[model samples]
Target: MTRSLIIAAKCIAFTCLLLAVVGVSLWSASRRVPKFYEHALTQQLPADELAEAADQLEQEVLDLQSEIQSQETWEVIFTSEQINAWLAADLEQKFPQLLPTGVSEPRVAIEDGLAKVACRYTSPKFSTVFSLELDSFLTETTNEFAIRIAKARAGALPVPLKRFFDQITARAEEANLSVLWTQQEDSPVALVKLPTNLDDVRSDVVIEVIEIEEGQIRIAGRVVPGVELQSMPQQPRFADASQPR
Candidate 1:
């Protein structure tokens, strides 16, 4: 009986040791888990990095928004009629001689600011090359010079041309449009006195080669101002027949 009791006590002791070992292992594991979690949390980004990330994202968004705003802001568009008017005005002002006489009405249409123009000439006048010169002088060259030339050309001496140019110059100035002349260095072939009004001016005003080097006269006012502008009307269908003399 004593032996059996002793075996039972040994069994109980072994069980108690196992329970103590298990308790110690659980405590060690618990301590390790907290340390590991602390290290992991330390490696994670802090508040400042999060703020930087937010700032970077905000900057990107702002840049995109700015780009969109700029595009919309520059979207001002011009109609075809307005563009054609500008071209016609420019042509009249720039190359008074090169511009065809009968181009009073220009048919204009615009698709996306690209001008499509069809103009009717009073008579089959100047050569195609001369007309092209007029077109180039208006749109391709420095428009500022054209303005000055327009102003200067009105004061020209070649009777009819002089009057025509003068009219255009006055019209431009009255409309608050101004031009600058670069050809001032080239002495004028003839000196045309300025007339205050279009009616007082002679119809003819071309620069005759007076004294090629000296720039002396047969002088007429550079431009003959104002006449046809009042006369030309926009008509839907125009007859192609020339007026009988």
Candidate 2:
């Protein structure tokens, strides 16, 4: 081979080796679940108790099916605490690596009509700490809910969350997390969104948060028919402050 071709081949080989090393490093980082994560999974209800409750729910549904009319609306209530417990359990089981190494487990709450998410983000070097509150409106859809963080407060300063989410997107991609978060538009107020691809579980699921109060959250959904609540495709969903179209 000529000198130029030899140098080109070496460059390609080196590039491939570098990519392989980086891929292995990221895979290793993702495999070691944090020791503290075990605590999050311990809140699941006992199996026998859960089975009994399910049986009761099935019986009640049978009774309702025999007695109730077609247009009746039924709602289920989940307390903020109960929601948080379930959220913690889910993260520990499915997305433990979504929580970065230096950050604490995320906390989710609902106050008024907004969903509040707070976490302490420590720098990788462990030198600086940031307390961040992501405040968003939890819009409801048929299959899943959409969360748009309208504003984020880092300590005392309120800032647009797009940049913070951009950083998270970089890290999450690097760590191979299951969820994808993207800022759909260039505007500062554009929504950071994710598609809840949940077609396998429920064909038509409607989970809408109807009320948010001090300790309770009420969600209304149809369990009978037309369960096609697929998460809407991620698009430009939020309106800019200057252009509310």
Candidate 3:
């Protein structure tokens, strides 16, 4: 072939190859984008989908970043997906369990300018048995050891069960669930505080639950005004931090 013709053919081939690469890149990008709700597609997407979207989002973000750097018109950039990731991480860390203080699973919902988490909690068990009639059993231990054994084994142990519901205000505050509070429409997600009537009062002092912050649950109320509270920074010497060795 002639030199010019060969050069032209090579140029055409290179152009076709470049076009193919561009087409493939754009196709890949489009595939990564979710077709669901703009917000969910960005934030609450399932794991695999979120990963794909994240890849695409990262590329787009890089492109946008460059554009912003050069153009100077687009100064601010905030994405729902980014916000969701942060929230998910925080929630996972704070509310890792579903019992004692949290619901089965964290349900995300928004209402009236607040992000409402419809979490559930069941009060811990508290049973006080004044007497199990151990005296009767003790008196006849030898006479009817076999009968007593049979009775204890076959019969239901009298629990004298007493159960009731109570609020989980203590755990909620400790998890910093209050700090994330925000009015609905403030962002892609916000916190809605669940109503709780928890008290810090004891027999000796009158303290009411005021607010929750940091690692401490706040209590503000009359305490006999000048009544000294024995400092308990360190619990009594016999306290156990965990199970008995």
**Index of the highest-lDDT prediction:** 2
Q: lDDT per residue, candidate 2, 95-181, as tens digits?
A: 677666766655555565655555555664422223332333343222323334444554434445544655765664564432234
State the lDDT of candidate 3 residue by residue for 1-245, as single tens digits: 69999999999999999999997765454333111223332447676655554455456546644543344232223243533443444445664663444223223232222222222222343221111111101111111110010111001122211111013224556754331211112111112132222233222222223332322122233332213433312122212212111
Q: Which 10 consecutive residues of model 3 have the lowest summed lDDT? A: 145-154
| lDDT by residue (tens digit), candidate 1, 1-245 | 99999999999999999999997765444233222223323443455653454345445445534433333211122333333434444445655665446654333432221222334334443211101101101212211112112111111111123334456546556656553222222321111222223232344222211110111111111222236323423221212211111
For the record, the alpha-carbon RMSD of candidate 1 to the native fold, in angstroms, is 37.7
| TM-score of each model, paired residue for residue | 0.21, 0.42, 0.21
The residue-level lDDT of candidate 2 at 124 comes to: 45
Q: Considering lDDT, which of the candidate structures 2 and 3 is the better prediction for this target?
A: 2
lDDT of each: 0.33, 0.46, 0.32
Cα displacement (angstroms), candidate 2, residue 131, comes to 4.8
True lDDT of residue 92, candidate 2: 57
